[model samples]
Target: MTTFYILVGYLALLMGLGLLSNRFFKGTSADFFVVSRSVGSFLLLMSIFGTTMTGFAIVGSTAKSYTDGVGVYGLMASWSGLMHSAVFFAVGIKLWAVGKRYGYMTQCEYFRDRFESDRLGYVLFPILVLLVIPYLLVGVIAAGKFIQPTTAGLFPEAFPMPNLPNGNPHPLNGGIPPAVGGGVICLIVLFYVFFGGLRGAVWANTFQTIVFMGTGVIAFYMISKNLGGLKAASEAVAASDFGAERLGREGMMSKLQFLSYCFVPLSVGMFPHLFQHWLTAKSAKSFKLTVVAFPLFIMIVWVPCVLIGIWAAGYLGPLDPGQSPNSVLGRMVGQLVHSPVLTGLVGAGVLAAIMSSLDSQFMCLGTMFTNDIVMKKYGADRFTDRQKIWIARGFILFVVGATYLLAIALQDSAHVFDLGVWCFSGFAGLFPLVFASVFWKRVTLPGAYACILSTALAWGYLFYHDILAAKPAGVGDEEMLVFGMMPVAIIIAISTVSLVVVSLLTKKPSEAIIRKFFV
Candidate 1:
């Protein structure tokens, strides 16, 4: 009960902080969408770092490590630490400069102008929304899974879910349940995002980053202490049946699989939310800290969660039948830590990491709809600043409702890491479109269309066949491969080839359009 109360109090404080940020709101669509392009170095770094470290980092990493062992860290964290920073330096800074110069607010706007095609915005908007929604779902689902187990038995009487004839609690029972947990989080994020906009989101992100990282270190230390120290924990894992494999001594992942994982980090270069964050920078110099320190921060959040998951294998043995691997982290915390206060603090930390990304995603989607669809199609001159803000709010509300419904419908259907990887793959496949649009002077509008269409077709087929209809085997069971490689590698290959081949075969863009982007 103390833990539950602490979690509630932490949430309330965040809500209050979000509302307080409304004082800084400048009463314009620009302020709402990109914080008036006035964000400085420290806030920019914290906001970018916080937004990138989602439930996918904390919950997904823990679950993957639980199933696939320590090699999970090598699969993502190590690569992301290096790749994410490199992308920020190579791509993010350049985009920020163009966005500031052109007064652009969304990626679709950039593409529409860069290609000199009015219709391209219409095509890109829906695809970006489609890719972003699944990423949003990953965060929502992870939040529910993390909250459900941590708050178990705290409100059994008040929130008694009726059991079915077979003795199950229908969807869930005893704990907070994924539906309720997810709803509360969605509402809280909506409250802050609706009122304060990007400023609110960034401010909340800065604070949450501190809470999560600080408490993350605390959780790591306490968990290690409880498990009889790091050395003893390693010894316990060594004594387990598959100890060497868990410790990465037996080459758990194939060489092809290990190498394929490298492409996954490229997805960051194309994340819409990240693009929005990039446009918020006050200057190109604001990005210097982000590129330099992002790798170190990845180490801060990922190493502990991965190790904790591996330790749980030796401590708790096998998972119960029909249980979600997503619940591993919460289950470990709830069972291992006796103090309710500490448990509550740790729960808040985990939620901090999850919700940090959710607000940015929710806000970025709204920014896109407002800038790309509503304002662009209807004409920005027709709508006042206040009306534009409200329009964005309305669209965001619709998105929130749709995402919540989907999350409830698909609870525990897949692993958080796998779902996230699929979503990232879709974006990563489109990286060629962004990379070429900036660097390749000969990239024509037709070539841009080719890249988008090829990525969508390839991603759609793979997703339906591999992810939805015939679900791939779980992590450690077998690799989910198309022609003996990850789906993203195939998707990227198709997208890049179509981009280059079509650009060469088709007529080039007019000199004016080329000069605008390339010059």
Candidate 2:
């Protein structure tokens, strides 16, 4: 199959790029973790923007629009366009400056010093890992979901399906299984990250970012042409049973819920991977272009995805029973694009978006585990720089494998948009702690501890009771509320209240501790 061959070629090119980047690796911990803090304006822009546009932007948005209609765009992308840049300007710049000055490598490292407590790093490490897995899962699962539909018939005998009663071939006649697709993609990401470290991830991200954004435009134009144009497609959907649902934001998503998504975008402020990217900036000025241009990049990728998904809602009608909305993007493209070459390019584009985020996430976790956990726990003075790099590589390998298996296990049940939103909510709920730690001069160690423990405990309870258990009693998620507000909104309140109340009532950090961080 030309599509399969082209897809393989794309994979090989990525591997070559990763190996090539290793040539520049300095073989030191600082260079591996943060590119020796020498990255410039353009690379910083590409990597930061690329890492943010995960499967959530491409696969999640398209699938969500397919189900929730054009309003899906309003939920995350519109808010993210405004909020993400605001966070980058307000929060990212400040973190980068402090991290550069203090020689910090991870968010937990910053916390450990900010509070003058090793116990804080120990407390925050597991929580950070837990939140990151779900977000990483979004990218891995999306890789599998997108690959299957476009690569159908490439392995029909190996992953065969039964024909219809009328003897017609099955819709998924032959496709790469989700498990296999996810595994292969994860392995490829691991290859580059293991060799290039953060530098490799950044370089790979720049290349993949360019590919996905450019091909996104091409796919949009070709698909619109295939559909007889967006205007004609809209008119057709408006005439269908799904018309009102596809065209408006009223039915499935309420005004309160729509507005509450603004809180979710605030999660970007707490992203560990994003923090790592911020520290890679050569100077504070490096962030200027990213803040100004991020919203436009969001528009470029998201507009095409949401528009295509709106068209697919009418074009595909009701999906077959048991089918996930994740299939909508590939199925729509495969059916409409028609050319194998074009189909391959779309597949490559989807994988590029997925992997761009994955590399950064994998690298960040490894860097954190090594810096905050391994070095501090064992003794930074004991190991050479090379050993530290190897330790990071080993941890990255373990996490990647764990995540790949988890993604495969949940492939059938997890919804892309739902999983991503939940992950972001956890990070968003903890944003108050991060914001206060950076800006609020009176924040205390006791207050920071209370904030993290309370927010995490509440987040876990709400996720289980409000979301997972809600289905048993016939309560739909969109209609569900906690005291007349979304669960995430409540989580933020708890985070803020716990920090302020506890800090006032508890012992304050010494003047020395305050002087170290504040000054």
Q: Which stretch of 10 consecutive residues in model 1 shows the poorest summed lDDT?
A: 470-479
| Tens digit per residue, CA lDDT, model 2, 1-519 | 999998999999999988998999988899999999999989999999889887667766888898988887888788888999999998898889889989988999998888888999998889888889888888888788778777777788888989989999887668987898999999999999999999989998999899888878888899898889878878878878875478888776778888877888889899999999999999999999999888898999999999888888888898888787877877777789888887788788879988999999999999999998899989999999999999999999999999998898888774544766678789999899889988887899889988887888788888887556636655554634676566889899898999999999988778887777775
The clash number for model 2 is 1
Q: What is the TM-score of each candidate against the true structure?
A: 0.94, 0.94
lDDT of 1 by residue, 71-153 (tens): 88887889888889988998898889889999999999898899988799999888888888877888888788778778777
Q: Which residue pairs collide in model 2, if any?
A: 153-174
TM-score of the candidate numbered 2? 0.94
